[model samples]
Target: MKNTIILSILLLIFIFNTEAQKSAEVISIGEKVTFFSKTLNEERRIWIYVPDQTSFQKKIEKRYPVLYLLDGESQFYSTVGLVQQLSQANLNSILPEMIIVGIENTNRYRDLTPKVNSTPFITFLEKELFQYVDEKYRTAPYKLLVGHSLGGLLTIDILTNKPEMFNAYIAIDPSMWYADEQFLNQTISQLPKQKLTDRKLFVGIANSLPPNVTLKNVSKDKSSETRHIRSILKLGDFFSKQPNKGIQYKQNFYENENHNSAPLLTQYDGLRFVFDFYQSDLSEKDFQDSTSLIVTKLRNHYQKVSKGLGYSVAPEEEFINYIAYDALGKKHFSKAKSLFILNLENFPQSNKTHAAYADYLAATGDIANATEFYEKSLQIKDDKAVQQRLLTLTSKGMTLTESDLIQYVGQYVLDDYKITIVLELKDGKLISKVPGQADSEFVPVSKDVFTVKDKQGYNITFHKTNDTITGFTSVQPNGIFKATKKS
Candidate 1:
């Protein structure tokens, strides 16, 4: 009887544990959450996955980088699966663990593009939608933006107009010539002559169009059967000629893939490009034994690849330089400085290397050199966050009193839609808040001009009426609106 009772208890415990495990995995691979959006005039749905690390003890303290995916309904499962496999793969530690936030499209044309035309089914993605996601998620400052097809075009638009919106950008077969080539031409004209700082951009092109299709004939067939191969080629050439500096960029033409088939291969290649060094076979021993020898060998390898592809070296500094930064976080300043200089030598135009070196110098009390390099880094790109840091350091003795007029902000109501703005202070900095969240700090670019550090590519302008900060305007590529202080 005693043995039988013990066996029964064991069976019950096993059943209970099995049920618990099944319950934990019950959430669909791409579960959707409805978020209220004034920009879309309705509740917007987004797909999200918190990493499965919650089940592991070692991963309990880890916070992950966030990857905002475009076309969530279509690509979320594939990307989430890819991220999980690649990050955990020993052969390709090319990507870190990241929280995948798939932004579902209620209207792709409207939310992704900066401008809205008379297109029958289009939606716009203003600051309202972006703020909603950030407030609702535990996002890190490090972010990667991704898109494919029309989504790819949207990715380019976001990076070009608001480079600060994401730390890295990946676009797969982006429709470069869409909207009468509106975004393409705009990007070409506004392509900054200076280097981008601490930024990485990767674009891929594939045999997406059917044979012999041209952009000029796109209007002839409105059936979505037409492929604009010529236009994609033109875009490829344009991106190829774009100068490389603070931004490390590359373009790949997948001869074997079409527009629909391109995303899979392009995504793999793009992630490799973004995190090249993470997959390097180098070990600590290799660096310690012969640092110069390893760098030389790597340089040779880069040269061969660049020559074969008719392009320059892959921006090795962008990925390799992170090693030094990681070391510095542990207070190994000397090692960090050495790596920073090496990265600068490899990628002279990269503003990140310079900025990182400046930080190292500043930490060591070498103020003059630090200031010089910091200025040089700023000259590469008009990044608002970098500008603010430089301002505080340069004007060390200046006492600046900034107020959060963002709080007295009000709603911009458009018919059935409403946008809520809140202001507060955090970490000794003034921040703007949208509905459903608290305020975070804003980085000032110029006098009365400020932007978010994570980019999101928003500009907040305060309005003064009768000597009171009564209103403000938040501007993005989609549209502009004036919000008055709510009484």
Candidate 2:
């Protein structure tokens, strides 16, 4: 048993290495790196967070938006965690999965100041680092900039001067009072003049209150404690009134949060607000809805989503599968069939999809078609459970010609349940599709007593006369069941 287990582990490793598409394993957290910058002429350490990759069989290619967050060294972990959690399929789908580029600051004041040229740093980001990230990683054309305090002030500068640098901007308790509010004044002046189509801005204001002061009282106070809060509010008010130059915008005030603690809440709300349409909100009733209306709604929703993202987007595979199964469970066969067929067309290469389609077909009494797809699935990727399922009710071995399998192809009905099993010969292979079940391919273990393929020892003993087979017995785990040829 020990040797067998070890051998199985080795075999699995070999299979994984051979069959799985080659790519870097998904990093749940992120990797810290020291990257040399040509624009800044210095080596910088940054943290990078990439989303967990899609299943290899799901897509041939994919890309994601990049969110460049300021103050990497301090905020990388929490930011990455927020992205990972929110983007999970089972969780809220409001925020699309994105790559988080945590930019570590070597000189915060030098780069994030409105008083300085800071063009070199901007050039480093816009030209050097941005290009590097896009070239090296799978990133979409859209980029979002996120910052806090002084970093937020820099965010405003870029938004005002080079609006095209990023598609979206989030300023969390930004020091709008920087350089005596010079950058804030620039934002107020330039925001209305720019062609802001397809652009968005989110501002999060932290409550900067001295003891005994309130949100209402802070606006009235001329004291320094209220300066940061006052500036952010003024900017938010200004942004809200900007003409419809096609930009989407919103501002959130965290009354309980001060400058130091605002990023935590604002970051979460900012992401939720910015990419609100990214998630699907399929209710239980929607799942149980009949095929035509439900599919149309889903398709339309994703179409609008695709238009927004500047790329074609589809309903998540799992979400579709869930609806399909729910329809199937409710006996909505037409809806189930349509969804299964649609899913199969979208992801024909996926083993899971094939198995699902095959299941639907078999359950619907389309045994021959089910078996064909099941064989296709197994050929693409070996699945033992499927093999056992195919035999205990079903590959690698000596190949058999089409002529050799023709003898095994027939319809046989079981004695007790009177269940009819379909045997088929396709593309030089023999297949078994049991009643209301998936197809399993057969292996030629021997002449008359050939064992089912990939069954982990399950065999079918055939009763033959010369070259013609009369019947066969299923060697499954429950018990042996005999069947005679019906035609």
Candidate 3:
């Protein structure tokens, strides 16, 4: 009896340890570093986050993609969290796990800009900053450069002159026309008729100037600032008209978000555009039924758009494959696998697609195929999180349990706006549906707090009186709406 009790205690401890190891781990807080600049001859500071590779599986050994961000002090944490959450959600697999470098500014004008006649400091980025980052980090050839305001101007300069430096570029409210109207007009004249190949650029314009402001050259009343804004828009219009061959370009005009509030919206939209293929809206079923036909149709569609717009559409396989993985997360296994195979034909380099397919294989108890694809994904990109998830799925058997139905349905009303949320139980899962939107399965984050993986823009919480739900609050992207359940 004594031996049996001791053995039972040991078994319990082992099980607990195994379970703990299977859970996901949060990314480590990034480090701050300051380096001497050669261009401006001043010190520049930056924030850096390396993915949690320590937890990565031993089978995978590889470097990762790099993202260079401006406004390090203000937006670093938010961008990092967004990348992690988006990747975890697997929404269209639009983003890949990579290192993020946030460049902190010593003097905004000196480092972020390309030229400064009024300011004493020269452009640090042009002189020594870019070389410094390359030397310090284990960066890959595939890199994305992001900036806003003066930084945005620098991004444009790089795109215009040294396009080979980075794979992707994002500029938010760039001061492109700051050098003067003559400089912008000259730049437009010098633009090449041919499209840039194998490159991507995203430009965002905010609601800084009123809509009534006239931009024509013949305008009688013109201020220097107005001319500046006009020049930037003119350049935007130019890019919009250019042919699509080697380059993919997009422009976003934010009427609601001003210059100060534009960064958040721009960052999200810019990333989405650069990774457009990964964030496609196609359903997994679409890919499974006819992968070849879908790819052909998409290619033809892009060819037409490219000819008319002067830029290439995102690769079809990447978009389809990402959609498949997303479907799998919602428990559609066969659909996910079919999409993965289709995507592999187009984007053989995408490791995320393989990893997602591996997950589907594991779910159906196809251990051999699951292991193969898991290793394949790791080979392309060393993703530790995926490896850990695989280990959990394989080792501990998971069982789905149904929960009892509860009454928590009601109409939520706020000032000037109304949102009706219906709470229903389906197969033991609490599902919430909003009018005109798709139903979302909510996972209880807390006793009364529930979250939907499908929607990041809102938070839904319920208030209960005794065993009955009395009221519920619906938090949206812009504002919050509260409603009491009708008695």
Candidate 4:
């Protein structure tokens, strides 16, 4: 048994490596775009990352919020990856997927710093970049701006002077000591008067203090070495004391992180703070209880989130579908029905939404409505599994009894490949297991046909002769292969 387990582990590793090798291709995160800036009167190169629309099941074109980043060449990749991870991976849904537009600097001082109350950079962004991005991409009204060091100074300047430009701002260790702390003083005075309602600002202060200095004594030192941190601390303290209109604000001090290493962590924290209402945490009890009022709760949550984001936000179709299915599985039919209907109403064009509703209907024994919904789903996309399901529902001699399914359960072998498959009945579901592979659950489409769950375009068809089980054939996209019954 020990030897067998070791060999099985090695075989699994070999298969994984082989699959990885097959998928070895150039992985690109974002694209570099160049356009002439009429405001600046020169060409500017920007890096852009837009979420792939094809990966989503919604047939309707999706629009996304945009995040504008300063120092595009350096910050573009990490920001893009962070957004993708937070929004897309493992159903995280912490933040909404956003388009990242990073502006590569031509001259840091000329573009990012204010020259005698004139902001040519702000003018360029407002007149040129905003128009370009909105025209070229499917962008929502929401926008965010992030900057560090001198860029952070420019960000603060924008927030104080032109607060309407971006919905949220992140300033990472800004050089507030510029020009005898003029912008810093201006920001402190102006912010209290400006009614920045629904707007957000996140300030990240890095440890710029000397080895001997601490937060308590740093305010007294006032040396050029501690000037950077002192200015930031002063600004933070003012924010804590003063009532800054209606703008949401947060600040963090990274004791061990310096200017260069602070931006990444700050960006993550800033995004979370800005969009804390994005994900609704639904507990397991909510799924198990039919009277939990999940539908009402979800509606109210999304409404609040929509208000915060300045858009009409709906719960994600996939999220709703998963919850609906969970309710259906737990036999909470009424709860499942309401959630499924809600999903359909929100995502009318989504194929998965229609199919999920169909599944709920089928489970509740509403065959006619289930068939209609499945057909509606197929009208949007040609899904083989749905097609098979429809065929099985309509066809005669396809619906099997428990005893009929039991006859097909046993061991089968492919002599040529030396492969064996064991089919077993577990909780009224057929399960298939092969050596060195994970067990796959089968969804019965017909008495003889079963589709592997989560495995697209793959089916197993059992053959019989003389009222006895003979064998089965594995039908895959590649080809159909036969296996002989061993029991």
**TM-score leader:** 4
lDDT string for model 4 (1-487, tens) is 9999999999999999999999998777778899998878899999998887313443247788999999989998889888888988776789998889999999888899866567888999999999999999889999999999999999998999889999999998999999889989999988887779889999999998898999999999968999999999988888899775788889999988999999999999999999998988877777678863999889899998899889998987777788888888888888889999998889898888898888887776655456567777887898989888766654322356667679878998975786988989887666888999999876666546666665555567778898788898876667788999986
Q: CA lDDT of 420 in candidate 1?
A: 60
Indicate the worst ten consecutive residues by lDDT in candidate 3: 53-62
How does model 4 fare in lDDT? 0.85
lDDT of each: 0.64, 0.77, 0.64, 0.85
lDDT digits (tens) for residues 1-487 of candidate 1: 9999999999999999999988885535445788676545678777887665322223343456678888988888888778878875453445655688888877677666556332221223436545655676555556788898788888877777677767788988888768777788777777675345767778877765555654445435544444355555566667678666567788787777777888877888888787664444567764554234555555665665444222354434545566666666666666666667778886677677778787777666654456557767876866776666656654451223544434443443322246666556555566566667655555554334454544343555666667666666656445576766666
In candidate 1, stretches whose alpha carbon ends up further than 4 angstroms from where it belongs are 1-30, 53-58, 89-92, 116-136, 193-195, 209-227, 280-487
* TM-score of every prediction relative to native: 0.49, 0.69, 0.50, 0.72
Q: Candidate 3: lDDT over CA atoms?
A: 0.64
**Mind giving the per-residue lDDT tens digits that candidate 3 earns over 1-487?**
9999999999999999999988858756588888886655667788987665322332143345678888788878877877766643433245655678888876676556554232223245535655666676665556788888777877776666667667789988887766564435544655454345768889888866645663444134366646545656877777777666577888888878777788878888888777665443445555555333454555565565344323333454545666666666666665666656766765568787777677778777765456556666766887878767655543332232443336544444433455556666787676777788888876553345544544333445677778787776766556677776656
Better of 2 and 3 by lDDT: 2
Q: Who is ahead in TM-score, 3 or 4?
A: 4
Total clashing pairs in model 3 = 6
- How far is each candidate from the true structure, as Cα RMSD in Å? 22.1, 14.0, 25.3, 16.0
Worst 10 residues of 1 by lDDT: 117-126
Q: Supply the TM-score for candidate 2.
A: 0.69
All candidates in order of TM-score, best leading: 4, 2, 3, 1
Clash numbers, per candidate: 10, 3, 6, 0
